[model samples]
Target: MPKIIDNLHEKIFECSLKLFGEYGYNEVNMKRIAKELDIAVGTLYNYYPNKQDLFFTVLKKSWQQTFFKLDKVKETNYSSRKKLKYSIKILYDEIENRKGLGKELTKANVIKKESLDGIKDRLDGIIRNLVEELKKEEKIDIDKEIEERLIRVFFLSVIDMLDKYAKEKENNIKFINYIIDCNFK
Candidate 1:
């Protein structure tokens, strides 16, 4: 007979998230995670096959949570500019909260770059939608491709910048607002 632990999966995920954020993916391992959770390493394996799987699961969950928050902001009775600003704020906060997890993931190469790229593309699509809405609202006469490319650049830059300088959230928000207000509105 097998013994079942209540909310073991959630427990594992929460522990992994904290461990990964604090020590990074490279420094943390299955043994350490299991130890922190007061479970046997084998039991942890039952939830996640390996370290990479666990890390990826935690990363995916974090992104989904950020997207969920952004969706709520979208549903609000806010202007397109407000929606885009709040969405960027949500993204910046997530990046700050991740605490070098991206760099660790890149260094470890545990997952293909395409998997991360797909996540970026999804986020880009969301930002692009908001940008397009603002552009249409303001009747801006910019090229679609150029607008998209700029948004991609800005999005990538924000991640890089925020990760490098953790204290720049307010400045990033201001910069984003300035860019959107100047060009889109």
Candidate 2:
């Protein structure tokens, strides 16, 4: 049945995500994924041409999911500052979510140039939107390219810091609030 086939596809995706997360992308393989899923190797090949293709499939899906979550919120209702904060917090929330950061990082690493560009395009698009929103409220001046670059630099540094901080044995809202207050202020 079509439903059963769809379920198998979903199964492959979910299994791959967890496998990649538990064992980094380089360490995981078709055999491991197939074994973990109790599916035939042939069945996996039915959906993926090869491991690289499968990894890109996973990577593309991760970006799609992230964009989908951001699109749900209408930025019009909030102040630009609030909207920008919401954007940053929402992404960090996604990154911390078991399904997002761990899987996305694994997904990104497995891909080559084209996929990396695709991921970068999505990120740059988000950053541009955030900057534009702030400009609307005069929170940031649009004329200064230097200020824009500086914001990007600070934002990225914060994200890198959060990525490492989140992996610590202790990760909670308290530290997150501290991050916002200390950095964004």
Candidate 3:
């Protein structure tokens, strides 16, 4: 007869997420996660083949939640600028709370280049929506090509700042507004 452990997968994921966010990719391992969950390392392996697999799973799951929230913000009836600002706030908070998880993923080589690009594409979609909205309002005087380039630059700037200074919420918001004012005002 097999012994049953209730919600073991969820338990493992929760424990792993907390550990990974706290200690980062290189600093964590199956044994430590198992120990934290009071389970055998082999049991963890039964769920996730290796550290990379586990880490990637946790990252994908976490990103899904973030994407979902961003989706909700996208659907809101707010002004385009307000929606963009709220979306950015959500992303900034995610980075601050994750505490270098992005760096860990990049440094550990856990996620593929294409997958990272997919994440960027999704974020860009959020920003692009704002551009579309502004264009509809006839607020953007730039040509399409220049508008696209600016969108990429703006997205890159946001990502850079969020990754580099996640803890500085005030400054980041101000920087975003500066970009918005300079471009749209």
Among these predictions, the greatest TM-score belongs to: 1
Question: Candidate 2: minimum summed lDDT over ten consecutive residues — where?
Answer: 98-107
TM-score (C-alpha, index-matched) for candidate 3: 0.83
If both were scored by lDDT, which would come out higher, candidate 1 or candidate 3?
A: 1
Residues 35-103 of candidate 2 have per-residue lDDT tens digits of 888877777888897888887787667667877777655445876656665666666665555333343
Question: How high is each candidate's TM-score?
Answer: 0.86, 0.75, 0.83
- TM-score of candidate 1 on Cα atoms, chains taken together: 0.86
For residue 52, model 2's alpha carbon misses the true position, in angstroms, by: 1.2
Q: Candidate 2: which stretches are off by over 4 Å?
A: 1-6, 98-109, 142-155, 167-185
Q: Put down candidate 3 lDDT per residue, 48-100, tens digits, no spaces.
A: 99998898888778888889999998788888777777777787677567765
When 2 and 3 are scored with lDDT, the better candidate is 3
On lDDT, the leading prediction is 1
Residue pairs in collision within model 3: none
What shift in Å separates residue 80 of candidate 3 from its native position after superposition? 0.8
Ten-residue region with minimum lDDT total, candidate 3: 102-111
The CA lDDT of each predicted structure is: 0.78, 0.62, 0.77
Q: For model 2, how many clashes?
A: 0
- What's model 2's overall lDDT? 0.62
Better of 1 and 2 by TM-score: 1
